[model samples]
Target: MADIDMAELGPDRTLLLVDDDAPFVARLARAMEKRGFLPETAESVAAGKAVASSRPPAYAVVDLRLEDGNGLEVVEALRASRPACRIVVLTGYGAIATAVAAVKFGATDYLSKPADANDITNALLSRGEAPPPPENPMSADRVRWEHIQRVYELCDRNVSETARRLSMHRRTLQRILAKRSPK
Candidate 1:
């Protein structure tokens, strides 16, 4: 496959990527390196913060959930360490509240998991791509909400039965669905 125009990023720059998924960290780091960036990978938020604090990077791609803690913490830490560094948050669970909170906390953008190297590279580059839409087909929130809404509606908004069908706690299901807004 052809590479992204690294010029879109306005000169190759250093990038810090924080994700606990080993394969994803390696794959994305390699891809960004090929795209003319010097990318660093961290398997945990603590390590990511350490790298950023020790030597600031031009950009950071942060995962929202980490083995040790929330990736948002890492983003905050990066911002504090290097106020100029750009940040993007990736998560398996993409809620609007979480996404909006990420932006409020200083992420330049947010992406859901299954995002490819190119998507991440573009985010790091600040190339003007919109934050991944909450309703996007790849979005975990859309998929989970739709499924829960279907069951809830089918069960006449009966929280217990809906939760049972989904194999989740009633309260957890309620919280998830509560975050859903009316169309």
Candidate 2:
């Protein structure tokens, strides 16, 4: 991916990048540094919390999964520590619930993994500079059904936990699962 133009980013901004993947974090930190940010990294959620508490970043790029805990915990803590900071959640192919929860927990945006540096740069300035998330082609019902399936997998086929996590009644989750499952 091409480097982002740092001239576009405002001056003297700080960015905190939290990702367990050391190589990925390094690359992104380099890219953001080129874009004029003073980027710091935390390889675990615990370290991220410590950094955030000591000096909140103006923006944070958080991966949805981490070694010690889910990145949602870090995202929530970051919000508490720096409500003024902009957050962007990084999601893998099948982790939509976590991504959605990130937005609900106050992430400024969410981007799918394998995203380019351009994507990261835009997310940083997304709050007032970028366009709104475009509508999905699928219907609301279809999106709900898809999210239910992802939740089921995330909970390791535990219907009760899936239901609770999705905020649906247990029976409702069962009904949805039944509809999607083989006879």
Candidate 3:
């Protein structure tokens, strides 16, 4: 990612990056530092909260899932500690439901996994009214898949339980889950 001008970020350039993926976080932290941000890192919800307790960073990038708990916990903590702080929720399992939930939980924006440093930086800086909606949103199949996966997580990945809840045959549900997410 190209290094953004520090002047554009203003004095609020401190960032708290909360993600369990060590390699990805390391790369992002280094990239952000080069872009002139004072970056702090936390690998779990607990650590992120601790960092916020001292003082919320001017911005935060929190992964949607962590070893300890949901990354929304970190977002809420930052919002509570400093409402002015900018927050972006990063998730591999992107879905309309989760994206809406992230924003409802105080995330300024939500980005899918594999987001570049520049992508995150841009999202964190964007403010005010939202852009026009996508002309073509996700397909029904994709939305159903996302909802099934979310329910599977809620059931602690119990295939039978999720199948029961969704009124799906066990093998059918398993097959749906096994397939890669539809575009």
Candidate 4:
């Protein structure tokens, strides 16, 4: 993705990035900083809420699930402190239900995980306009595989539980899990 025009980001460049994945968050913080944002980062919902309450950043990128609590709480806190704050919610386990809930809770946008810094920047700076289509969208099979993998991890790698939750035969789930992820 190309660099965004910082002039369009308005006068307030403060941005808060909250995610439990420390390395990923750190990397994103660096990337955002290079994009002309004054970035602050938090690794959990509590920290995010605290920052939002005390500082009230003008922009935010938050992971939907955290070790301590839901990211929506941070979004709510940011909105409460700065009503015009641009907040984007991200999750590996993205679903329509959660996306709707995030928006209702005050997020400006919701994106599936593995979103790059460019994607996030566009989301943050968008002025109620839909973004252009992805340059190379994931294939349907890859999407399904990724979703199944996420669910499988969430189920603690229990094949029976994962299969039961997905309503697939145990053997079939096992086969799918064993295969390499599709492109």
Candidate 5:
């Protein structure tokens, strides 16, 4: 992770990280703490909202999907409690519509998973400037795979429904889902 300057750490360095993935959230919280943040973590929308309401952090990293509900609800709660909070929306299912919605909910940035600690930190600390292009952008094939996987998930992993929605052959969709994601 890139070292963040102390001056840029803001007046309050408390950070809330909300993700259903327990291991990911724990790892990220540890990483952020190493960078001088006082990190709090939640694994569900309800918990996240409760934490936000109780004490809105100075910054937050929220997943778009949670086991209990949409992470956007948590975002909204945080924004309502603390308008100045810098929130970054992170998700595995990245799409333009969701990204726009995240911004509309007062998120400072939207990042697709699996974003590293460095990327999250940069987004959190950015001063409204457009971020530089990704050092290693996803390939077209990877993007397609991600989209298909997202659709498959949305369809409750039904092969036929996912294929029909994507206009792809059922067998082809099955093969893609069976294989590991491309780099």
Candidate 6:
């Protein structure tokens, strides 16, 4: 595949990527490095903050959730350290409230989790009010299914706890969990 036009991000093109998913971050960092960014990675909010404080990067892709505290704190620190930094907030949680807060706190754009390298590159390069709606938007049912799955995982896949938290009947939650994800 062709690489992104990382030149648009300017020279040296340091990128801060903060996510707790080691495998995902490692893959994304390699892809971004191939695409022309010198990527700095952190698996937790503290590490991300330290990296940002030590040397503010021009671009940052931060996960909304981390092993310690929220990524929004990193976003805040980056904005303070380098007001011009372009920041994209990615989250599997995908809630409007946090998205709004991210923008309010200083994110250049907000992307849902599973945002691929291309999506992230585009978001990092494009300075805009918000990143474009995903090229292939998930269908409503599919989005709902994904949200349910995210909550399920966050709740440690406990049907009773997930149901109680989601305010759905345990059987209903179980059925949803048993079925395949929507397309």
lDDT of each: 0.80, 0.81, 0.89, 0.94, 0.95, 0.89
Output the number of the TM-score-best candidate.
4
Q: TM-score of predicted model 3?
A: 0.72
Ordered from best to worst TM-score, the candidate numbers read: 4, 5, 6, 3, 1, 2
Candidate 3 segments whose C-alpha is farther than 4 A from its true place = 129-183
List model 1 lDDT by residue over 44-81, tens digit each.
97898899789878788998988799888888888898
lDDT of 4 by residue, 108-133 (tens): 99999889999999899888887899
lDDT of 3 by residue, 1-183 (tens): 666877778888899999998999999999888878899999999999999889789999999999999999888889899998999999978889999999999999999865788778878888766745555677999778888988898899999999999999999999998999998
Error of 3 at 47 (Å): 0.2
Worst 10 residues of 3 by lDDT: 127-136
lDDT: which is higher, 3 or 5? 5
TM-scores for all predictions: 0.70, 0.66, 0.72, 0.94, 0.92, 0.91
Error of 1 at 121 (Å): 2.1
The TM-score obtained by model 5 is 0.92
Query: Model 4: what TM-score?
Result: 0.94
Give candidate 6 misplaced runs (Cα > 4 Å): 1-3, 129-133
Separately for all candidates shown, the number of backbone clashes (residues 3 or more apart, or on different chains) is 0, 0, 0, 0, 0, 0
* Model 6 weakest 10-residue run by lDDT: 126-135
Task: Give the number of the best model, judged by lDDT.
Answer: 5
lDDT by residue for model 5 (49-146), tens? 99999999999999999989999999999999999999999999888999999999989999999899999999999989999999899999999988
Q: Which stretches of candidate 5 lie over 4 Å from their true place?
A: none
What is the C-alpha local distance difference test score of candidate 6?
0.89
